[model samples]
Target: MRVPHDDGPPPPPRPPKGRKRPGERAAEAGASDMSQEPGRAALSPTVAGGEAGESLSLRPQSLAEYVGQAALKRKLEVFVRAARGRDEPLDHTLLHGPPGLGKTTMAHILAHELGVRLHLTSGPAIEHKGVLAGHLTALGPRDVLFIDEIHRLAPTVEESLYSAMEDGRIDLPVGEGTRARTIGFELAPFTLIGATTRTALLSGPLRDRFQIIEAIEFYGDDELAAIVCRTASILGVPVSGAAALEIGRRSRGTPRIANRLIRRVRDFAQVRGARSIELADATAALLELGIDSEGLDMLDRRLLTMIVENFRGGPVGVEALGASLGEPRDTLESVVEPFLLQRGFLLRTSRGRVATMKAARHLGLELPPGWQGALDL
Candidate 1:
């Protein structure tokens, strides 16, 4: 179906013509307007910093092209259609979940489906009120402003958005001292799309402002395998279904990692002079990368090992674990622990993190007898 144009009513009068727009000035100032970050692990489900360009190209442009999140996709399709039909901007939306589940991509797809421009920024990127104002004022009618890691926005900056999101205007302080005065400016109607991994960090008021809230779940292996194949196709590398599935199985249920792994596997296949990727190529590549059959990587194993060996099959707190492992608590909670918990290798109890019996078996370690009974496992 043809998407309706976003040109509903003319936008409110914009700043005088010749004066550079806030968006333009912000762009020139190098505001954190980028969609993805840099320097993250290839296996991380979050956008890999090093492969931003490739990731952008691999991203599905429309909801139909997106894989996984069946329920979310259905909801978004209806929402997008309804919004477009009404010639109105979509309601403010908040997407929260673990990273790498395509929250950013979904934002892009929303803009694409709505036939509107997308303005990208992050919570931390809006360091102050001025930066937030610049981004807010830059939006055109029906445009999408996607703020990734929205939970990280400073209290002041986040509060500044309340009025803009609710009433389509902002009151900013101008001048200094006795000359200081508040100026309220009317803003063009637009949609705000906020994504966050730590939803709990968001203020209640802020969370309540979003008209639509959806949680992104991890992809199923089948969905991830399809993503693998799609990425391989986009990279012009031939991949067998079996190979794609194998990569997907080891992808920790994340498309970013699946895409990243396929690229590495392709490298192995190319070096071996193979015309296409096969199961063996994927297996060997993953083995060389130290990702086990269960998708546990070095860091995962390290965390498990620490719990098993040092903490005696831990009921250890995350803080203690982080201190011992020399890793950040946030990294442990967000990245390493989720997959382990999902795969039954770890458990979180009132006491702390506990390595499960399955984890002990995987590590080939013999836990003390009666330990399972004590832990009530």
Candidate 2:
């Protein structure tokens, strides 16, 4: 991206009819700017139009407003302060972790603190070299370009970012045949903020370009309780500490899920004409939504039951599991599997997914006949 210059004079008037102008023809060919498509516009950290019906009003807009991730916050604070002290853009940063843990919120807070306009896009939004070149060329000095789900970026598009990150330039091939040549254009010094749910899918070369790679951790129950109270206060939905604690315990250690549950429970409370959410209300609301005391929803229980009964708790491939559940493999891997694996209810073996004995006991189901010989049963 070219930085606008203050010393530049205004362009001359358009030429007379039938007399072609030198810059007019070039401007016609290259003046079109990038479009703000729906996907790109929805990438903002604000919860408005976010996945799972989360409200942007509930999202924390600053570092102080953000909850949990103390260690990562401290590291980022020092890093941001140092960069601001030098009056320079922050270096490329990569945030990796499970979804709904405040990675997007942190990126927004960083740009806000630096007093720069943030450009939001995702890996799937940018396609081909021309589209990427347009975005990079539009950046101003010290601007922030946030790319969510960066692991999904096409390999060719990811490679195009290499030069932009390392050298502040992009080499574009112009013309064809004998006239074809690579043109290197300098970009304004800018920051690239990448967020990903799965870091393993990112290439080593792309991962190494980032100066700071931070992993966001799941929030503890107490932290989630505080988040619940904070969100309730913001949304004007009264909630008692006891009720908040109960909701937090079943939130799967995710703020997004906690906030979502709060909305549902609040609706129940309002319908009942109660002043505030109580323990019973929280339980009833979550149960109605299929979330249990252990935070295992119906799908989770179904997964466990299927493995125990049909597969005999033996190893089974994810494809077969998804086929049985009628869900896409990616959905199960990214959303359901993580929490199940974290809680040790499910194990991934070389062969496939194996149901653990703990899972059976949690569901109050007896082991199948002759199940004792099953691996890890």
Candidate 3:
């Protein structure tokens, strides 16, 4: 479908020829723009290393190329079609869920499907109001400003975005006393796409600003297998269906992890002088990486072992768990805990975290005598 680039026709001539626009003037004055942050030339979904770095090339450019999230895709397809029919910008959208379930990919896909330029920034990157202003004013109508880790936005900077999201304008406070008038700068009607791992950290007002809020769920094994195979094809590595499924099983239901594991497995196959990746190659690679058959990595095993040994199979608070493991609370909650909780390896109760019998069995350790009945709750 031919997506609308801008909101209808261009505005009639407002500024004379050769005159700089407000945004251009701001740029000329060397205003700090977070969108121009170093190493942000591309909306890379992963860090620079191994398969993570290679994911940039594999990132889906359009909705058609995206994988998984069937429900989200169906709704988004209808929404995009409707929005396109009206020649309007998509409503501000907030995508919240655990990391690496394709939030960033979905953001890029939305902008691509809208046929608009995507402005990328992270909440921590927008340190000051000038940075936010610069980004807001620079956008043409219907452009997408994607902010990752939206929950980390500073209160002041986040407040600065309120008017921009609601009224399509920003109030710039200038001067003092008698001349302390706030100048309202009109912004083009653009879409703000905010992604966050912890939506609860966002202030209610900030959260409410988004017209569409959706949580991305983890992909099933079949979906992850498809993702692995597609990524293998993109990386020019031939992968057997069994090998792909094996890698997917150990991906912890995340596309990023699946792609990363596939690459590592492919490397192992190459080093072993194997012609193509197979189930054995994937198993060996994962074993070498300290990822067990149940997709439990070093940290995951550490957490489980710590709970079993130290906490007596756990009823431990996340803070206490983090303190014991020397890992950050955020890391424990967002990274390690999500997969464990999803896999039924761990449970969070009113008291604290409790490891299940399955987790103990995975480690080849017997659970505490009463633990099985306790886990039923």
TM-score of candidate 1 to 2 decimals: 0.85
Off by over 4 Å in 2: 1-54, 369-377
Stretches of candidate 1 off by over 4 Å are 1-53, 373-377
- For residues 195-277, write the lDDT of model 2, one tens digit per residue: 99989999999999999999998888899999999988876667889989989988888898998888888877766656678
Task: Report residue 41 deviation for candidate 2 (angstroms).
Answer: 36
Per-residue lDDT value at 312 in model 1: 84
Per-residue lDDT over 89-176 for candidate 3, one digit per residue giving the tens place of the 0 to 100 score: 9999999999899998999999989999999999999998989999999999899999999999999998989989998999888999
The TM-score obtained by model 3 is: 0.84
143-215 in candidate 1: lDDT tens per residue?
Answer: 9999999999999988899999999998899999999999998889999999999998999999999999999
**Which parts of model 3 are misplaced by more than 4 Å?**
1-53, 372-374
Whose TM-score is higher: candidate 2's or candidate 3's?
3
Rank order (by lDDT, best first): 1, 3, 2
Candidate 3 weakest ten by summed lDDT: 39-48
Candidates 2 and 3: which is better by lDDT? 3
